[model samples]
Target chain A: MIILIDKKGFVLSLDAAVAVVLVTIILMGSAFFFLKTNETFIVNMQMLRVGSDITAVLQADGTLDTLDPLQIKSGIEEILPISYNMRMLINSTASSSIIIVETESAQTNKKFIVAGKRFFYAVQGGNAYPSAVTYEVWPK
Target chain B: MKKAVFFTLSLTMFAFIVLSLSFIFAGNAATDDARFMELASINRIYDLDTSLQNSFSKIFSLDSEMTYTASTTEAIFQQKIPFNFTRLNNSFNNLRNFAIYNDKNVQVGLLPNNVSLRVSQAGIVNWQNISKNITEFMRTNSTPKSYSFIIDFFEINITSCSSSSASGNFSFSVAATGGNGTSCNQTLSINPLQDASVEISLGTKSLTVLFSNYSASVNARDNKVALTSRINYADTGVKPKIFLESKINITVPGLIAKKYGDLRIA
Candidate 1:
């Protein structure tokens, strides 16, 4: 029979609880957005790394130096994962470039794409020739 | 009422703090990610540069090896240098996107016109065309040690004056002079002579020499030579994937010898 409660205190407590809930909802929304963007960024970085490694190995093996398409194809096949698609643009001159090699995996409609480029030296006709190789990669 | 206000203020402050901390962490994560990517790109560039340097050194080494072996006669040179030479050539064919821009006809001496050898990936060894190119280049440059082998004589007989069609891979004219100062121009063929004695008279002196018992010295000056070389992988049917259309100026030193001599062709 001694149930004496302060209406003011009850009202304050309820209001505080509502504020906390709203703030929590906002925090969660922002965190979700940020984390999702971070994941996407990380994926792109990984793609870039893979592309760079492929070009480096080809250059080191003298396959890039000779412009051997068959060897280059085999090298790429060994390095790239089965789930990814890759295309290469090879050009001798900076201006009026040409598409030397282009390849894609069985899966199409890739959701993400990244590209990396590097220059390599090629010897042909008893001369040293310089060329630029660009690789475009994406997950299937 | 005052307590309620205070509670609301504290809750708002806590939420802001949480939000601010998360933003800061996100920023740091983004910055770290960008930095990592930049570092990776730089590393790749360095690797590519190093690879190019190593390849260049290999090419230079091959060029030196060929230069040192130039003293061997043409036949030996042809027989031995193809393996190393093909490797040298294969290096050129490996680049897929390579371009060479040699606008000026700068005489890159590595493939000087005087060095007659053009080997394609199809395993075509055209020595005669190469010889013609080299002879013209040497004549233009007036380079010393520019010797050519136009003909090789294995055996020949001249019991009587007779002319026959040239059947050997190479043909050349020979000049003979007896001790008596009588000089005669003789033609030698690669076919073995059949039981014949040759006589030459010079200035009131005649020397008889048996064709079968004599050794011949062969010298070529600005001559064309042709030989067929089978590439090991030609049967594999792998065509050259890349053909470099650009003209680059690459100076390969000591690619061709100044002179080749002392060829005793039996």
Candidate 2:
């Protein structure tokens, strides 16, 4: 038996190769779409938006300057919605760890977190202190 | 061969359509991310603005306005407060401690080079050229937005005999021993931002004309406040709504935002 090679089959081979590549890409794209759709995208985005708004309101009223855990906790509680829970971690030059303020549910059991970090300066004793405040929000 | 070629072309076209659809959806996602980031960036910028402003006031207030305890003394600025581009930038940078912020590959960070202060009051052309003695100290302040000035609004050098009473945002009675005593009640409008004067002569007897907060306060007491005491004139430098605006640009991987917001550092 002699092996036969046909030059005319070249285009057919090229098409098969191209088709294989296309099919793989389509599969990968479909997988990505399905995976993405399964996740809580809107909730996470809402969390981010909520976090941003919360920080803005806190910074606006000069409440961030106090650096008091209790005060910050109250401020967050006032701004955040009833359904969401938030925890803030503040780091300033004046103290190694100034305060970490959070709601009860924010620290509890399960976790789906969206975090935003903001840089601000707080006035402490006639001097301004630069601070990095991070807010993490999760749905209750 | 023809059928194979047609099939390949058809598959390529289908792939292109899928990719285009993906891009359209991806574009919307990018927009959402930008919106959220922008909102956050603006809030943070606002905080930074107030912080810088409050810091400026604190520094100056420590020097003059707030108390006289440590006048001309602060870690921020030495000798005189810097108003130039370079010095002010240096001063503000010295005030903050952003460990590794605005560094390479930072997804969200302020571009340090892009942060700049506009010290010259907007309306006053070439304010940078003005000296500290005249611009900063002598006159309280006059800006495009608002002004409260402590300027010598009137210079009355009475050379001859004259009895005169003045009105309009201010009032003065010069009991002249000898002025151009034509019994002239001059109704003059005062615009201190510009060089303004009413020369009334008190006959070689030197009279000290003092302008206190009264000029500004009276002008403020009435909106478009005119003395209108048989005289109608309004010259109020807008009560000096002082604010220091800085242009700062923040950047993410794909977005660049230039903020010309008022830092309110005054």
Candidate 3:
């Protein structure tokens, strides 16, 4: 018995293999890049969510009624991500005042920051008062 | 034939890697979505709790106005306390909807499996009219992870009137148990006998007028109370009405670990 190989067919097969390898490499690179970029998006959204949640909790517990800004600021700091920096401000319509509840810096971890704001009603002196609280967050 | 077989194997390996990465990315997305829903649900509960506190404050403030009618010496001074029932109902609905939305997944459970509203009043008067039924949501302990809310409403009433004009004294007081710890009280004393009308101010915009005939003895008072004189006062709990103290307590499954990403597993 004897076997014969076609040179043209062998060359075509080699080219096809090379193309497949190139396509795989491109696919792998793009997928890795996409995942890396999404991490930033996720972190920003998480920070904003944290701010809105803390503000809503403080308002609901009647802590806002005390007219002391520090109470809510401290609460936000407690629930927030440890690596993130935060600042809170309360704007009151009744008193026409803007109060800085609390502020902190994450120091070296301050890159890629985001902020969130929320509005809610607070009862003071037997009347409903509307207030706006803003939260600024950054990874530490 | 050998080259063909090698090419087929390479393509299969590449496809598998891509598919696995896709699945991992999808899982992460689902976790983020679940976390958002959880945060939203928590915010709603907080708002509802605050609304409950405000309503109680308004109701208590209106109680002061009840004192205005006492000036006539009526056997029964009845005044209905006005509260925003619609707002209360709306808050309750929001709370229920968010709770369901936040914990719909099988992975999430209502730790205690029940919600309750408990009312503790100072008196035994039938308060069904002023009270909202809470037994409907009450439940016992259960396993599958759950959440429950306990609302406390406290009421204290004080009423006193004297028929004698010989320097009599009347006092009334009501207190709030928690959350700021504030108490309110009123005291009035009439000097030696005189055929004069006495005015007593108990709260913000609350005043009760007492008419006395200096010569009439304490035993000559009649059971009938004349509504001839009406004094309008701001509704703040003063004379004899329901005084409410409310607090919200929540019990739900929680983790000692402080990672937002862990909510997916929770």
Best by TM-score: 2
lDDT of prediction 2: 0.46
TM-scores of all predicted structures: 0.42, 0.46, 0.38
What TM-score does the A-chain of candidate 3 achieve?
Answer: 0.69
Compared with the true structure, what per-residue lDDT tens digits does model 3 show for residues B100-136? 3333321212212122121111111112122322111
Name model 3 segments beyond 4 Å from true.
Answer: A1-10, A37-42, A105-117, A123-128, B1-266
Docking class of 3: incorrect
lDDT string, candidate 1, B1-266, tens digits: 78778877787788778767667656765676566556545544443434334443445344423321111112122222112344444444443224123211111113222223322232222232232222111111111121122211112221232233334422233344323333445454433322223344322423332222112222122222221111122231333221111222322222321111111111
Classified by CAPRI criteria, candidate 1 counts as incorrect
Better of 1 and 3 by lDDT: 1
Instruction: Tell me what TM-score chain A of model 1 achieves.
Output: 0.77
Worst 10 residues of 3 chain B by lDDT: B257-266
- Score each candidate by Cα lDDT: 0.44, 0.46, 0.39
How far does residue B101 in candidate 1 sit from its true spot (Å)?
9.5
- RMSD to truth, every model: 17.8, 12.2, 18.0
Regions of candidate 1 where Cα sits further than 4 Å from its true position: A1-6, A65-70, A92-99, A105-112, A123-128, B1-13, B29-37, B40-44, B58-266
